[model samples]
Structures are given as C-alpha cells and as structure tokens.
Target: MRNRLVAGALCGTLAVAGFTGCGIPERSEVRVDGRRQPATESGAVNAWRKEPPPRSMSGTDPEEFVRNFLSAAAGEPDRAYYRVKQFIAQEDDHRLQEKQGSEVELTVVRLVDKPVITPDIDSTRVTIAVQQVGVLRTDGKLAPPVSTDTRYEFGLRSASPAGSVDDGAGFYVIDPPNVLLLSDVALRDYYESQTIYFWNSERTRLVPDLRYLPLTVPNERRLNEVVKWLVGGPSDWLRPGVVGLPDRTELINNATGGNGRWEVNLDMSGDDRTRADQLLTQIAWSLPEFDGQLELKVRNNSVLTEDLGERRSARALYQGLDAPVRYCVYEGSIHPLGIAGESPGAVPLDPGANRNVVSAGFTRADKQVFAALVTASAGRQRLSVGTGPAPVTTFTKGPEHTAIGRPVWLRATDPHQPQGLVVADGRLYRFDQNARMSQIVLNLPPGSVTAVAASLDGRRIALIAGGALYVAALNLDGGTVAVGPPRRVATSLTSLSAVDWGDEERLIVAGAAGRPAIYEISVDGALQTPLKDDTGARVTHLTAFPTNPATKLPSGAFMYEANNVSYRSSPVERIQREQVLDVTPPPTGVRPGSPSAPFFLF
Candidate 1:
C-alpha cells in the first residue's frame, strides 16, 4: 500500500515534469565520477579548508549548487530518487517510509496542519508537515500509502531567493531524471554527502539544516543500531551549553564488576547556575539492583572547606581518587554542615533543610562507620539521621525507641513528636508517643496497601490498597479515626504507588493502570482532569517539584522507570527531551568496565 503511493508519486512527478529515468550506477562508476569531480567543486570541501576560496572562483551560490546537484543526480533517475530519499532519510524527515526491499516505494504526504514558524531578520523558518509513506513489497502490487505525518521546519538562511535566482529560491524541484529516489543506501549516502554540503557550502543559500533531521526509518532493528551509533557518534558529542535539562541521566561505576553497580547522576541544575553549582557537588547515586538504594555524597572539597579545612583539604583527597568526581564549589562554606548515613533503607530528608548533607553507603564493616558517624552527628545535634533501627548501645541516649516497623516513613510534626507511619503485615500503624504501642487505624486486607500519603496538615491520609483508593481522616482533637470506604479508581490498575499533595485541597496520584495518567483529586473526591492526555506505559513513580506561585509551571517532578520515547503534543512543536541520570545496570552477559582500576587494587 505504501509502496504504491510512492511509486505513484514518483511516476506522477515523472509524468508531470516529463523527466527521463536513469539507472542506478555501479559503485565503481560512481566512485570514478566522484574522484573526477574536483574537491573544490564539493560543497563540504570549503568547510575544512583553513583559507577561504578565491572570490573569483567561489563558483555558484547555494541555490545554484542545489540545482546543479539535483540536475546531475537526475541524469540517473534511479540514482536521483535514491539521493533524494537518502537526504530525507538521513534527516529522519520521513513520516511515510515503512518497508524497504528492491523497488523501494516512498509516499510523501503533506501534513494537514502546518508548523508555526518564528522567523528572524536574515533567516525565515518555514514549517511543512510531511508523511513518508514506505512500502515493502513481498508479493503483488505495492499497497496503498501508509503515512505518518510529521512536521519539518526548514530555515532559509539567505531569506527568500531574489532576482534571476528567485526561480530556484524558496523550494524548487529538480526535474527528474534528476529527482532523487527513495532507497535505504541511497538515502543514507545522500544524507552523508549533503551533510558535507551544508557544512561547507561557500554560498549561503536555501539549504536544509541536517542537524534538525530525525532518523525515522521504520525498521526497528536498523533504527536501533543507527540510533545507538548516532547518540554516541562524533556528530552527537555533547557540546558546551548544549546539554539540555535531561529528562533522565545515568552513570555507571565499577562497570567491570564491583557488585556490578552503577551510579546515575542527574543535572537538576535547571536554568539557575548557582543552584546547579550547588547540586553538581552533591552527587546522588541510586542502586537499581537494590531497589534504588539512593546514596547522597558530598565532594571532598565541598566537605573539607566547610569542616576540616585546617587539618585536610578536599583538593588533596580529590586528587587521590582514581576517577575524578564531578563537583561545583560555592562561594560560602557548606551551611548546615553534617555527615549522615543509613543502612539498607531509604532515608527521607526534611524538605526545608539546607543542602549541606554528606552521605555514603558501604557494604559490611563500612556500614558501621556510617552508622557511627550518623549516631555521633545526631548526638551532637549537627545532623538528624532517619533510620529504621539503631543498636540500642550505639545510641548515647540508650535509643529513644519509636515503635515504627520496617519500611517506616517519618515526617517531622511540630518538632515535639515526629509522626511515624508504618506499613507492616498488611496493616497501617501510626506511632504517636515514645512508649505507646502503635495504633492500627486501618487493617488492610492481605496484599493491599501498596502506598500511603498524608495531607500537608497531617489531618488526612490517602492509601492504595487492593487496587482501590482509601482515604482516612485523623480526628486529632476528637480522638477518633474515620476511614472512607474503598473506591476503585481504575479496575485494571496492577499497582498504585506515587501519591502526593498537589495543592492544599487536592492530591496528585499516579501508578500502573489502564493508562498512566496524573490525576487531580479534590478534597470532596471529585476527579478533575488529568495532566497527561495520552495513554502511556505504566508510570513507575510521580513526584512534583515546588511550583512558583507566580508562574504555575511545575518546578520539578520525578517520573520513575519511564520508557525512553518521544511524543508530540501538536504537529509543529516537539518537546525537547531533558537528560536524566541513567542508573540502570547494563544487560546480563555484558561485563561492566571501570573508568580506572589499578592492577593491584582489584
């Protein structure tokens, strides 16, 4: 079906333009032609030349260059089609190309909606909607065009074509046998060649910026291979000031096999340089193998300058580490200084605390060092360590025991008594006082209570148990608890986890369900609109950043275990992906390699 459309379109162009067809040239013959062509005649040759070409021999302008190239390619109809397809494919501008085999057919469809272009003085951007219709023929005639609409923005570098050249300016069609055809190798080669042209062309004229093209060929296997190479290729190297807010970032340590661990560091710096500077120094490492066992560590310099500057400096210790640790130093010493640790558990920090916490994770005996440091820091009132169980003797105050069970979540309440909520044995327990037995406000059925969240005032709690939404209100003054009857939010939901207060009266909840949608629930139990309009893969987690009261845009949010994919909110504008830390370990059988390891160290 797609092939038929492409064939029809190509035949239509040939018939309408009265162009001749050319055969695919042999590789040897093509190479001969390429060699005979002076390097100076090549568009990209000038880009690498240190000296500019003689003004007299600058040759034709960009528009003329394009016309000439098209005309030359047209001499070989098959080659011309291949070149055109090659250029389109390289730019990933194809929305239609699907299957590839002999007699490749490509259907080019214009998008119903055009892109919105914001032009500058010398340059004007024109957005066109197009679909690449691709068809692979196994038998019979090509099928009808199967199109995928995509919008492409082309920047006219030298404004609209003017004077006698105006005919070739804007967009011009190279009469076929000169028009390029659609083919895998042809498109690839064409793009490779054209990229050179765009990069080096001496005359500034209408040329497609290959930089903005997407590699959209339909073959998943081929696409994956191409994408992998492109992402890591020289053409894709991270440029200064080009690192956008990553939707995700990942790091691997001991890639060779120290427990086969990796650390993903996120540049949450946003647009604020100062905030980014502070965030870069404080590294956060998550262990995917161990349920995202997050460890927060401070750079030695950041730590030393604030605490042990007189005895030792960070510059000294940092220089000793085999691998350089990434960090940014702030002007002032670390404020709210402290060292803290937790063993085999998630440590929830106060939202309002200063960003001066230093942490580390250790296996075996080193865990003791972390525990001792945390204990001493807590004793000195320098750090507040949130942990599950501290050995009674380790606590200088003989362990002011709070009967919170395993997987306990603590939130500071009034400083006098921190509130502890425990999910244990399929029941929810609230620990109020030091010696008092924990209160079982709600006894969840077996295999229920997947997640729990409290309102800002701690007066209400939301829980997901047995695939249902359960709300419980604590009557602090009345000394009573009212549990709302469980209500099914979505029957197909496999799991419900992330839940948070969206605002004073609304709760934002997300999870694995019919569709992973961020829902806004009012205090009165009205389900407002969802933040996401499309049904996506199950949402692993949802976190909201503090929103500026002035601007309603979300400041930050955490989306866990997200599938790395792209989506379009509209035809013209595509949301750019922000890089986040990639903490995930490599696949099995892939041996991890370390950045550095001394022969004797391992």
Candidate 2:
C-alpha cells in the first residue's frame, strides 16, 4: 500500500472500483495512525494535514536524496517547488525555477516495483518502473494514462568536486524527469479528494466533478484551485456529460476567503446577465463544502443586486432529490431499512398482490413508484412497475433460465414520470415514461451485459459485460433515448460481477483478478482505489448513494451482497461496509432468504 502498487500489479489489470466525490462518501473507511477514519477531510471532518518531507540533508548519498526528493514532491506544490528543487543539481534547479505550471501535469501515483539505482564511475541513475494509474493535471483533473508501463530515469552527479560519489556519499540529480513521482502512501497522505459542481446538459441541476487538492496547502490556495478548475471546465471524461462556465470565463482574481465568507471575481464582463444567474448557481454548488457567504463580481460589477447569503447551500438550490429512506425487496413486499422510530413493516406498491418480487428498484419524485423483477416461476422472471394501490403493470418477461439484474431507476427527464433500465441476459432495456419497455442497442465489447447502473442525473451509465466494465454517455433527446459510443474502461479488472454509481464520478464495482474484491473507480476509467472489506465471497450486489449535499453525508444506506449474504453500512459509520447482522437480524430487515438486490429509494 505504501508504494501505491499499480492495481494490475496487486490485483491484476486495472479493474477499477471505489467511490469518490465531495458530497459522496468513499466505499471504505481509511485507517490512519491505527484508527479508522472518514475517507475525506473536507467539510466538518477533523483537520489534519500530512507533514511535508524535510529538506535534503547535507552530504546525503544520491539514493537518499532521490528518495527524499520524491517524498517532498508529493506534498503541496511549494512556491517554485523549492523543497524538491534542493535535491536537484545546481544546473537543473534553474530549469525548474523558470518553468511555469501548465493546465495539466502528470503525477505518478504507483510504482510497479522498487526503483533500480545503478551507480557508475561518473554518474548514478535511478530508474523507476510504474504501471500507469492516472495523470494528475495542474487544473486538478485526473486523466487516464495513455500508456501502462512508464519509466523514469533520474541521472545523478556528485555534488563534490570529484564529479561522482563513488563511495555513495555525495550526489545530486543532474537530470530530473518532468513528472513528479509519488508512492501511493504519499498520495493518500498528501492529497484530499474534493468535488466541484458543473451544470448538467439541461442546466437544470449541478453535477458533481471530483478533484484532489493538497491537504497541506492553505485553504485559500485549495479554494482558488477548485475555482480555477471549475472555470477551466470538467475533466476530459466528464466534459461530454456536463456543461461548464462560458468559454474564456477565467477567474480574474484568486479566490480569497477566511473563516467563512469568500469572494470570486471573473472576467466575464462581455457576458449577459442571463449567464450570470447560471454562473452563480455553479459557483454556489461547487463550493458548498467551503461553507460560507459568496460574493461574485464580474469585472468588479455585481452579478445580482439581491443578497445571496442564504443561497450558498447546494441542497437549497437542488431540493427534494435526496432519498429519505432506503428500501429492500424481500418475498413479495418492500420494506424500509434502517429507518429509526418506525416499524419495520412492508410497504405495498400493489395491494393484495403476491407478485413474489425477488429484486426491485424504486424512484420517489412527485410520486412514489417502483419497478420490480418478479419471479413468475422457477427459471422465469417478469418485470413490473406500479404505485401505491395501483395495479402493477407487467411490462416485460425474461427468457427462461437466463439472468436478469436489478433494475436501476434513471433520473426522469420529465417531472412526475419515472424511467428505469434493466439488463436481461445480454440485452439492455429501458422502461419509458408511459411504462413502455424498449431495448437500447449497444456496441459494447464482445460480452453480455450482466449488470448495469446509471448515474442519478441520467447523464451516464456503467455496465458489466463479458467479465469487463464499460461506460457510455446517456443522451435523452425529447422522448427518444440514445446511448453514446461505449468505451471499455478498467481493463485491469479481469472479471466483473456487479457495478453501480457511487456518485456522479465514481463507480462501486465488485469482481477480481485473483480474488473477489470491491473497488472504487472514477468514471473516466482512471484512479482505482480498492474498498477495504473482509468479505471473501464474490460480491453479487452493490447499493450505493451519492452524498446528499444537504446532509454532507451519504444520501441513504450503502449495502452490498456476496453469495447471497447481505452487508450494510450505517449512517453512523458513514460509508464503512459492515455485515447487516449487526444492525438487524433475519425475518425482519435485509436478511432476505433468497437472492435479492437492495437499493435506496431514489
């Protein structure tokens, strides 16, 4: 773990899995200083910063200096990268000093093996071999690597007059690579993940975009970085799904704030007032974690005359979208999970109907509705949708002895009308607003889509097909639905069983290269972090909730299953996964006697 061993090296290939985002919670509780802790340090979490590595010691050997330089480079980008520059040769320091930061920069997150240090008569070379994990850009967006095997050679010369430290006493890196090399442990210590917001294609709601900023850096610097990234736009993979600030919309001045209030000035004087409201909306949602009054001005002119002091909350802007409770379908009834002070009783969607629902997905918007895959008989299944006291409408039936995954409810483009997606056998189908079911053609990799999950915003979809994972943009044009070209992501995952959206940017996936495991992967196919859990059984189901901007906590309960055994993460535990037995026992809650897919009511 210290080395950030590339996922492929540790688990085989890059079967990306894990969850990340500002309002979203990661799948596992990270351990630090021998105690379990929250995965992120944003918002009200305890403030602890990773100490910066010390400056190079005098008379240190080439190997020691190289090691120290790497450690320092992993921390906050110091003024001119001074601390790291100390280990460079005198001639190399001038080059680094004159270099200006660009829109993006590559940072090495994992090393495939120990660096090879070879010393010669006149120079030393430190060859680092790494498997591409992700490219951390200067704009705070992470891009997937174009290559898998990356090698960097650091050439060193003696700082002494002899030109070389033959006895390994004195040396400095004479030739340094352009990219920063960081061990995985250093990445975790020095960086904290944060999410900024962008407008959805419809500009109806803000979508979450994830970025990691240095924990040791000052809050103002971090805030400025977040704002700049928001202005620069979303990451490459997310660009197609979200809208950003208008073109050439650059921050005129750095974001400055302390205690709570912050002010952002932009160079959008040429833009009209119509864009001003949308601009403020994006800034407010993106900075929800900053928790303060925001003053926005374009070329020193106020965007709005009304005070926005109370409108800084993302929840205030996007209301009624968060799920109030999680639900689980067992036998023939739906029951709420982990709702306090309420009886653990079944809520009937169809009164007097014994449909024998085995798995279900529901949506709660203007009205409560649910879609269920009912067991018609042994080896046969039927998909149905209904509301309270309404006769359940059976829309489609699956072929005998074939597999049908849990239906995923898509965020409706039309109000009060819900839509859903299901994958039966190898085919994918969408349930339209009128309860009409139709198959959506896909040109995915040569594998059957066994599991599918869609983002809450209805902008993207993730699929597990043929033991691999794929992602595509979900395009809703009027009443017609279209899936953009599918891109094969997380090839590092040799096999995949279940997939679900952890947030707008990350996916919670279950599968393995050598053993059954769960991983959180960014939607872009880069940045895979394993979810620490004890379950050895192959994960069969995953139920995750994006962080509710209102609570700054996960929207609802998080649960997953392995070999039909269910586990759930309580609100008290945040996103840490635990066996459901600790919360409730059989015949009452999630202890479904047979295979079931648990989900939150969203």
Candidate 3:
C-alpha cells in the first residue's frame, strides 16, 4: 500500500507541474499535504476542480519581439528608437540600467523571445525569454562588439487577487557557453565584415599621382608634359601633324661668328619644285629674327644646255663667301630694253608721242615743275644727258645706272600746260620747244633739296632741305614762293631720300635718322604722327602704286627699300603707311579744269 501511495504522489506532482515536450509526462497527481493521491476518478475530479486557468504571459507581442530583435542588431538608441518605436510600447514599470559617476547608462535595445507562464490553484510562475541588447562605455578605444544569441530570464507576480499583473521585470545577458559576446578576434572580424565592408562599398576607386615617381616607374606624367609632347615643344621644333601634308623641309643660310658666311643653292627641276622653294623662302624671310636675305635667280636650262654641251634645266644658284661686302643677285626672265641715247637739241616736229624726254642745257615750261635729280659731286651743273656708248640720262651720283636701277615714274598736270623739272640744287628748268636746252624759269634756294613731290593739282610742292620740310606754292605765272616757315619734322634726320604725295594736302617722306620711319606732314605746316614707330633700319626710298578705282585697292605694286633690301609691299601695308600722312581729300574739287581734274577720280 505504501508503494502505491508514493507512485500516486509522483503522478499528482506531474499533473500540477505540467508536461514539458522534452520527454516529460503531461500531468501529475498529488494529495493536498504532499502525500500521494490514488489515481481514482474521484481524486482526479477534486484535483481538477482545485486548479486555476493559465495566466497570460506579459510582453508577448510578436511586433515587440521583432522590434527588439532589430534594435539590438542596429546597436544605437536613436537609430533603434526611430526604427522600432512605431511597432512596440514598453510597459509602465520597464526600467533601463543606470550608472553612477563615469559609468554609461544602458537601455533595453531589444528583446528576442516569447514569454511562457505556468499556473496552479494558489500560485503561478512566469518565464520571460529574451535577448537583451546593451551598450558599455569604451572611452572610444574601440566599438563594442555586437552581442548575438543572448538570452534573458525573468519572473512576474500578480498584483491583486483579481490576477491583474502588478509588475513585469527582468535582468538579462547572454549565458556563458551559449552566449556570443564580442571576442577580440570576433570583434575584429566583425568590424572588417560589417562596418568596414559596408562603408567602403559606396566609395569611388582610387587614382595615383605619378609626377614624383621614380624614373623606373611606368605611368602617365603630369598633364602639362603630355600636352607639350602632343603639341610642338615651346621652341616650335616639331611641325603639326596632318595627313597628306608635305614633310617639313628647312633651307638654312647660316652665317656664324663675325664674318662666317654660307649660301644655300636650290635647284628646281620642275614647276612644282620652284613653287615649293618660293613658298619656303617667303616664310623664312618673313620671320623677324632670321636676319638673312634671299635671292632668286631663274635661268633656262634648255637654252644654256643647247648653247653649251648638255641641256641645262632651270636651276637656282647661291654664291656665298666671307667678305666685307655681300651681294644677292635676283635675275628674272624679262630684260629691260634700253633706248640707246638722249637726243639733244632735237625736237619732234609734232611732239610725236614723246611722253618722256631729257635735256642737258636750259629748258622751258608753260607751268610749274617739281623734279628730283642726282647731282654731280664736283660741279653745280646737273647732267640730264648721258655721254657714252650706252648713253642714258645721269641724275643721281650715288650708284651707276643698271638695268635694275632704271627709274620710271609718273608726271601729270595739265596736258595743255605741262609742269617742267626742278633740280636738286633748287633750280627750276623748263622744257624748251627745241629740246636742246632747258630755260631757267627761276633760281631759288641753293641748299640741297633731296626730294620734291607736288600736290595733285600742282599748286603745292613739298621739299626737304637738311632734314627739314618746306612747303611752297606755285603761282599761275609759274613763279614759286615759300608757303610756310621751314618746319623741323625730325632733328636727327641725316638724309631725305624720297617723297610721295599721299594726297593733295600731305606728303609721305622717308629718310634716315637713328632708324628709318615714314612720316606724314600737312602742306600747311602741320606734323602728323609717324607711320610705323620704328622700322629698325634705314629706309632708302618709298613709292605708291596705282590702284583699282572701283575697289580702291592697289592694282600694282608699291615698293620700299629698307636695310638695303627692296620689298614689294601689299596694298594693305601701303594704306597703313598712308594713315601716317593724315591727308584727306576735300569733298569738293580741289583741282578744277586740270588734267588731274578730280584728283582722286578713279
């Protein structure tokens, strides 16, 4: 009977304790005084009547569970609160961990499990299963490792006999063996995986600075170096690259040291070669620093070879040698035909298309005359006729007359009354009808007059004396009188070589001082500004070219001699020089009923 009694007590205890699914019985039967109760129908009824219904566990909401889980995973209060506050509400008695002096406060970051409850007739036991998330102060040494799979256990008691809950409380952390606390290795690995990996995911790739790299390093240099190589170097050593362009060629005439001189000879076998050579020569000579001169000579190879032994094609010859004197000969195909002799004392019966004529002795004119003549060094007499086998009029004493030096210019006034000539010595001579001698119209200033240019209407003339500018008027009776006081245009003017009438009111004068510059002056004694500031060399001569009337563009070539080099300038350059002259034609006719009637008339 005792054995039976013990077994009955054990079964009663099992019924009250409730069955655990892990190999435990569903119920236990025990007496009211810890004695075993018989497993009879009556006993079971009494025991069942005494038992109470199961009380619900506190904090069992699924949303709360999930919120707690995520908050703990995130590990920041503000971030967790913002993320999870919408889902769960804490019970009134919920308490956060607080600290004293330097200790950090800890709050419940998350709860991870459902609560379970067991109940009997007189008492109840509650089990709160949760994963607690918390923070500890690290003094910024390193961040605390995240806790994983941590568990919490808690208990709750009923506040009133009515079974309303008084308090739900818990204390928690991960248990020893089952807990995943932050280990040194684990924390480092976790940091590298979770924090660092996530941070670096959004960053851009890195590039390197290569300028300071060692010589053996292979990398792109600075952008500037790359650009310099692509373009030409600063010295412009490389030609720009272009498809189908001609290879760059250089023709250098290097004269090294004081008197070391060399000349480059170019031979052209075809028209293409000649064209190329000419273009290159122009480009080289145009540079301001080249300081070299070029000469082009063309000879017919066919003629030379036919006359000699072999057929000689067109060839270029350059002769260069070190010497005190330098000369460049430019010879073209056309040879100037010369009129052999001056017919002195002979007059045409009808003036016979004699557009140009010369007289050695006294001459006469119907109107005023402006002329430039080269003087004899010893005698005051001016020679207008040459005496030799190849006789030509001798004017300038400077250089001998050559094919290149033959002077051709224009003269105009009234065809009915033509202006005559004025010598450098300021003697006015008129063309006589007999053409044998010049009739002295007037003897004026005996000072050397280097240049004389007449206005379009022949009413005014500009004369240069001792580097001074003088303006004079021609009376209707062919008399000359000074118009204004002698004006000093330039004090250092050493020579006045040429003068051209820019318009009816101003003159363009070229001469040497320190350097050559072209000046414009008004016939009324006004000085306009110089044309170019400095040409860097002396100007020997200047002349205007004929232009097209319709376009007002020069139709022929204007010429200037500078640094012993003659240049055929474009019309644009000539006009730029004209601006220095400051001469403007009046809207009305200045020369009426004259051959150059409307002075600018086409």
Best by lDDT: 2
> 1-602, model 1: which lDDT tens digit per residue?
00001111111111000001121111110110011111121122223211111212213254332323222222112332444433232323353233344354433232333334445675444554544323212211112234433544444343234444443233322111111223222222222211100110111111111111112211112212222222222121111101222233222221111121212222232343432232222211001012212221222112111221211222121111121011110111111111011011222222232132221111111122111111123323122223222221221111222221122222213324444454434456554324223535454565545556554334445667766665544333223233433323321223555465444334556554255654544322312334442336654333332111212222212122224332211121111222111223457997532111000000
- Those runs of model 3 whose alpha carbons end farther than 4 Å from true positions after fitting are 1-417, 424-446, 478-494, 535-537, 545-558, 570-602
Root-mean-square deviation (CA) per prediction: 26.1, 7.1, 48.9
Model 2 residue 143 CA deviation (Å) reads: 1.6
Candidate numbers sorted by TM-score from highest down: 2, 1, 3
Task: Summarize candidate 2's per-residue lDDT along 1-602 as a digit string, tens digits.
Answer: 11111232244232122222333443333332212222232344335655555644635555566556666665544342665676677788765533456733545555656779897777877898765666666665666665555777878777666644355345677777665555544544566656677776777766667676666665556557777888888766566667777778878778776556667788873555767777666666555444555667787776753223455643354456743445565445555554332223234354444356667776655544555454556767666655432234333444343556788877736655566788876788887544466888887656677888987767778888777777776666564567777666643455688888766566777787467876766665545656633347787788777544443444423577777656655322222223111233356455434324566664
Please give the range of 10 consecutive residues that has the lowest summed lDDT in model 1: 1-10
TM-score, cand. 3 vs. native: 0.26
Q: Write the per-residue lDDT of candidate 3 for residues 1-602, one digit (tens) a residue.
A: 01011111011211111111242322223322212222222112223111111122224433333223222312221232222222222341123222333243222222223445455354333444433322322111121124443454322323233444534321111111212122111111111110000000111110000011011111111111222111211111001111111233222222111111112322333464444443333222111122222232223121110110010112111111011110111121011111112111222112221112211111112322212222223323332322111112322222312111112111322334333434334433333211222333323445555555444333344556545555444333232222322323322234666665554334556665356665543332212324433555666555432221112222222245565444333211211211211123435955311010000111
Model 3 poorest ten-residue lDDT run: 193-202
Model 1: how far residue 467 lies from native, Å: 0.8
